[model samples]
Target: MASTILVTGGTGTLGSHVVPLLREAGREVRVLSRHGRASADGVEYLTADLLGGEGLDPALAGVETVLHLAGGPKGDDLATRNLVRAAARAGVKHLLYISVVGADTMPIGWFRAKLGAERAVAESGIPWTTLRAAQFHDLVLDTVGKMARLPAVPCPGGLRFQPVDAREVAARLAELTLGEPSGLVPDLVGPTVYGVAELARGYLEARGKRRPLLPVRMPGKVGRAYRAADNLSVTGALKGHRTWEDFLAERVGQ
Candidate 1:
């Protein structure tokens, strides 16, 4: 029998891309969803909620590896705790978690939650691998557009980012799920690091709109940490093939 891999948040942006690749690799993929949606071809969809702890046991039964991707937007610690306990009960062999780059160094609440989740996975007694990746290109573009809509793009002064392609990240994640569990692999980053203002300019250019990028000083420890270059990875850990310009041109059209 093929090894079963349970993918949490299987209908999400990254999961949509990942599910197809896992199926193509001939693995039995099971998606944990809340709505109990119909399973995709060569994949199974099971209803499970991380917070409610509902339908987790049967969904995890016979699953050797778990690609844990579900978590609260702001606080992942509680959800991660529940997942760890459930995985322990199910006798899961390996757990692969996807985290953000600079999660440990950044002072943002979201990053803190991610760090807490990483701690849980490390101490869960299940062999685990955690991949910390830079912000996705789509996420960067979306944020820029949203800020621009406010009539001003707020770029934290001197903040740098190495935004990566979500597709590539998903591919790497699928590869990790099939490999041996290693603790905290090297951070994955994009081809280059660009200033937030430049990123915003590129976004506006793609949309054929001109907008002033207002560099503002955010007032808080988290804002200060975000303004620092420590949020980005300088050393290329996981090299992405696509560039930001390429992504924008292909997706948004030049």
Candidate 2:
């Protein structure tokens, strides 16, 4: 029997894509979530809180591989530290973590938290792989969708994104999870880089809506980091096939 692999945040968007791929590979899958769930589709569901470190011992018992996909706007460092401690005690062989591109470069609180999470995984004393990915098309869509609701969209100049499909990231993660630990793999990103204005315009065009875009400069060091494209992986990155336009066409224009 294939050893069971535990996935945290398996119910979220990225996890939604990843869980099935693992199942298709004939691996017994376990998902750790905050709420209780019934086992279905060959996946065992376990209730645990990564942040408060509750129920982890039970969750990690006999699990050799862990995909640490659970994260949030804050406290990711603490949550990851909590999970790593348990994974260590449980004798997990391989630990995989999903982090964001520019987690170490961007001067933002969320980025800092992600970097901290990365640190925790690296220091966990277990074989680990961490893949930093660019922003997902779904997340960008939400950002632009909310912006479209305003009369005139505040398009922050120098704010750019390479929005990749979540499914593509999931596939990559599944491939990595099944293999040996490869530390800090090359980043995964979309095929094309787009300015924030370009992304917003694409969304507007897809929805058949019209909105004037106000060009505004982002201030402070945070803005400087964006302007420098610190959040992008323009070189030495594995690019996904789908473009922002393709995603918009399928999700909005259709």
Candidate 3:
């Protein structure tokens, strides 16, 4: 029997990619979600709520490893605590967490929450690996898509991003799940850094639409953080093969 691996956010954008990779690597995969989704031929989907702490024991039973890809804009710390507690009780050997690049230093609530989650994993007393990645290409597309739908597209002139492919992140997470726990590694980023305005223009070009580009400065400290490149990786820049242009060309361009 293959070793069972539990994934908290198995249906999410990154989780969607990670699950298949785990299966391909000969690990039996279990997904914990609110909805009791049907299981595939080699997959098991279980019901669980992180906030309520229901159904975790059974979902985590006999699982050797956990790839925690489940997170949201809110309640990151609480969710992580619930999972950490459950995993500790269940005797899970290795735990891998997914966090965004610059989560610790960024002046954003979501980042703060993520940093807290990272701390939880570190202090869990269980062996773990936490990988920080640059913004996913899909997320960037979602942001630019909303802006590109109007007469004039407004973009953050100084806000920079290294939009990485989710598959790459998933691949790295899978590697971590199968290996010994490494505390914190260098950030995985895209091949190039792009300002938001440049990305907005790329989005327009991908859709074959020419729109007026309004470069605007972001307001507030969070905006200042972005302007100062707090969102970018400083030293450990593990470059991903895919770029914003590649994603746009394949996904958006007709």
Candidate 4:
């Protein structure tokens, strides 16, 4: 009999892509979410709260592998710690986690939380694999979209991004989940790196709107990190094929 795989945040952007791939591979999928859903076909949906550490035992029962994709701006460390304790108790064989590229180097609360979560997964005493990925195109779109709404978009000096497609990250994660545990795999990044101004230009052009970009200097340690490209994975990382242009063309239209 095929083993059951547990997926946290299976309904999210990346998880939405991952769950289907695992299902198509003839693997049983159990999605743990904050909301309850009726189990259908071969997928099982369970209501659980990783942050609050509630309803974890029943969720992990009979699950051989765990794909932990759930995260947020804060409390990720605590949430992941909760999940790790439960998975350890459940005797789960493989534990997989998705994190951001600058989790360690970036001096930010969010990145620190992500790094904390990574540490939790690694120290859980279970076989584990972690893939630190660059920012998703969807997230970049959200940021740029909000900026476009303003009369004058603020283009922070030295702010740049490598926006990888969510689908590509999802596919890599699904592949990792099915394979044996490989600790701290290579970082996944997009093909092209774009400055904030360049990204805004693409967005404004796609919308057929032009706004004056106000050059603003970033301040403090955060600014230094961006200037130094601390969030980027320039080399020794697996690059995704899709470029930001490809994403803009498909999402915002030519």
How does each model score on lDDT? 0.87, 0.96, 0.89, 0.95
> lDDT per residue, candidate 2, 1-254, as tens digits?
66899999999999999999999999999999887789999999999989899999999989999999988889999999999999999999999999999999999999999999999999999999999999999999999999999999998999999999999999999999999999999999999999989999999989989999999999999999999999999999999999998998889976
Q: What tens digits encode model 3's per-residue C-alpha lDDT throughout 20-135?
A: 99888888899987777888958899989997788898999999889898888899989999999999999988898999999988988999999999999999989999999999
RMSD of each: 1.5, 0.7, 1.1, 0.9
> In each prediction, how many residue pairs overlap at the backbone (N, C-alpha, C within less than 3 A)?
0, 0, 0, 0
TM-scores of the candidates in the order shown: 0.95, 0.99, 0.97, 0.98
TM-score of 4: 0.98
lDDT of 3 at 18: 89
Error of 3 at 151 (Å): 1.7
Q: Could you tell me which 10 consecutive residues in candidate 2 have the lowest summed lDDT?
A: 245-254
What is the descending TM-score order?
Answer: 2, 4, 3, 1
> lDDT rank, highest first?
2, 4, 3, 1
- Which 10-residue span in candidate 4 carries the lowest summed lDDT? 33-42
Candidate 1 TM-score to native:
0.95
Alpha carbon lDDT of residue 114, candidate 1? 94
Instruction: Give, for candidate 3, the lowest lDDT window spanning 10 residues.
Output: 33-42
lDDT of 1 by residue, 70-95 (tens): 76676587777788899999999999
